[model samples]
Target: MSLPPSYLPAGGPDPDGAAAGKRTYGPDFLTALFQNPLDPGYSDAAARRATEGRRTGWRRGLAGGSSALTLVVIGFLLVVAYRQTVAEEPARTKARDSLIAQVQNRREGTERLRAQADRLGDEVAALRERALGGAAIAELKDLEAATGMAPVRGSGARIRLVDGPTSVDAVTGERRTDGLVKDTDLQLAANALWEAGAEAIMINGQRLTATSRIRQAGEAILVDIRPVASPYELTAIGPDELAEDFRAGYAGPYFETLQGRYGISFEAAEVKDVTLEAATEFKLRSAAPSIAPAPSGSASSSGPGSPAPGSSTEGGR
Candidate 1:
C-alpha cells in the first residue's frame, strides 16, 4: 500500500531526546509510525538474546540470595554456639576455683593442727613425768601420817548447791523454796574453804579459777559461774587444823545454825589428793588486740595506735 510521506520518521536525536521531556512520544511524524504494528522479523535474534539474558540474570539473582541466606544461618548458629561456650566456661572455672580453695585451706589447717598436736604431746609427757611420783607421794604421806589422818584418793566428796528448800512458813507447807540453799550460803562456804587454803575448788565438775564468779540458778547457788545442784559439799586440802579452825570459826557455826533453823541436813567427807583440771579457754572473735588494717591508698604511718598489735602497750591489770 502507498504510505503518505508525512508518515516517515525524522529528526532522530540523542538516546534521551531532549524534546521527549514531559512527554514519552514526540509530537511529530515519528510518533505516528510507532502507532502501527511492527513486522514479524523485526526483532528475531534480539528478542531471543534479551529473553536469555533475563533468564540468566534471574538465576544469578537467585544464587546470590541463597548464598546470603546460608551465610546468615551460619552466623546465627555460630553466635548460639559461642554463647553456650561462654555460659559453660564460668561454671567450670568456678567449680575448679572452689575446689582449689578448699584443698588449700585444708592443707594449711592440717599443718597448724599437726604442729599443735605435737606440742601437746610433749607437754603431756613432761606433765606425766612431773606428776606426784613415789617421792612426792612420800612427802605428802608423811605429812598426813604426822597429822594422824590417812591420805585418800580415787574418790572424794563433791558438794553441789541444789535448789533451795521449800517452806510453807514452816507451818503452812504452801511451798516456798526460799528456805533452800541460797547464793550467800554457797559463797560463805566457798570463802571459808578458800580462806582455809583449798588447793582446788569446783562447781558441777568445773574447776573454779581465780577469775571465777558465783551466781544463782533457780533455787540453787552456782559456784564459779558453773550451775550446780543441791547440798553443796565443799572440800579443802590443808593442815587439818587450819581446815577445822576455819570451819569452826565460820561454816561450822553457819551450818549448825541453819540446820537447826531449817531442819536441813549437813554432812562432810574428809579426803586427800583431790585432782582438778584447768578449764579450756576460748579465743574472743570480736576483741582484737591490734588495730585493723586501714583503708586502701592511705598513708603508711596512718594515725597513731591505728589498731595494729601492741597499740595499747598497756600494762597488765
Candidate 2:
C-alpha cells in the first residue's frame, strides 16, 4: 500500500522502502483513541485500550467532589481570618459617638448647676446685705475682694500660650508631644504671673482663686476641674508693666527654653482694661471668731470712763 502524496516528504518516499519515514506525531493518535465503535478494529481490546486513556466515571466523580470540598474549606478559612483580623469599625465608631454624647450631656448639666449656684449665691449676698447694714456690707466687699469673689478690671497683661505646630522629625521620624501644652506649663505660667505681681488672674475665662486647681487629666488641661483647650488665653489684672515684668522674670528664661526646645508658643501683651469675673464662692468648712479675748480687769467702756453707763461713784463723793 502507498501512503498519500501529502504524507510523503519533499523528495517522496522510497519506491520499495522497507520502513516509512519516521511518522510525524500528529492528531491521528488521538483520533484512533476515540474512534467510534462501528469503526474497523473496534474490538474488546481496542475498547479496553481507549478506556485507559480516559478517567473512569467513579474517579471523575471523586475528583470533582474533592475539588468542590477544597474550595469550600478555603472559603470558610478566608472568612474566619477576615473576621479575626478586621475590627468591626462601624460598631466601634458608634460606641465612640455614644461616649462623646454622654460627656457633652454631663458637661451641660454641670454648667446648668453652676449657673444656678451662682444665681443663688447672688440672691443670698443681696439678702445678707439688706439684713446686715452698711458696716457689714463694707466688710463683705472687702472679703469679696480678698477671696476673688468680685470681678476686677484694670490695666494688666494678657498671656497667650498655644500648642506648637505638629511635625515629624525628618531624621528620627518621631512624633513629638512636647509641642502640646501641658497642665504643668499652665500652672508654672500662672505662678509666674502671680510672682510678677498679678493681682488677679484668669485662665481661659475661668477665674483663678486660692482654691482653683490647674492640673492635667489625660490629654486635657483642667482649670478648676473644668477642661480648657488651647490656645489658652490667660488674663491678669495688675500693674501696666506686668507683661514686661513677666518677661524679665524667671518665666522669660523658662519660656525661652520651652520655645527653643519644645516649640511651645508664649506671648504677653499689656492691655488697658482686662476684666475677670468673680470666682465661685467657696463654702467655709470651719471657722471661729479671730478676735482675742479682752484682758481681765480691762473696762469695756467706749473710752476712758468717767463712770459705767448705769453706775455712779456716789460712794467716793
Best by lDDT: 2
Cand. 1 Cα-lDDT: 0.56
lDDT for each candidate structure: 0.56, 0.75
* Clash-forming residue pairs, model 2: none
User: Candidate 2's residue-wise lDDT over 1-317, tens digit each?
Assistant: 87675576446566676446644343465676687535565576588778786666998899899999999999999999899656676788889999999999999999999999989999998899899999989988877765677888788999898887777878999875667877766766777787788888888888887667776677788877788998998898888899999889877777777777767788989989667888864555776765998999875532111222444222111
Each prediction's RMSD over C-alphas, in Å, is 28.6, 23.0
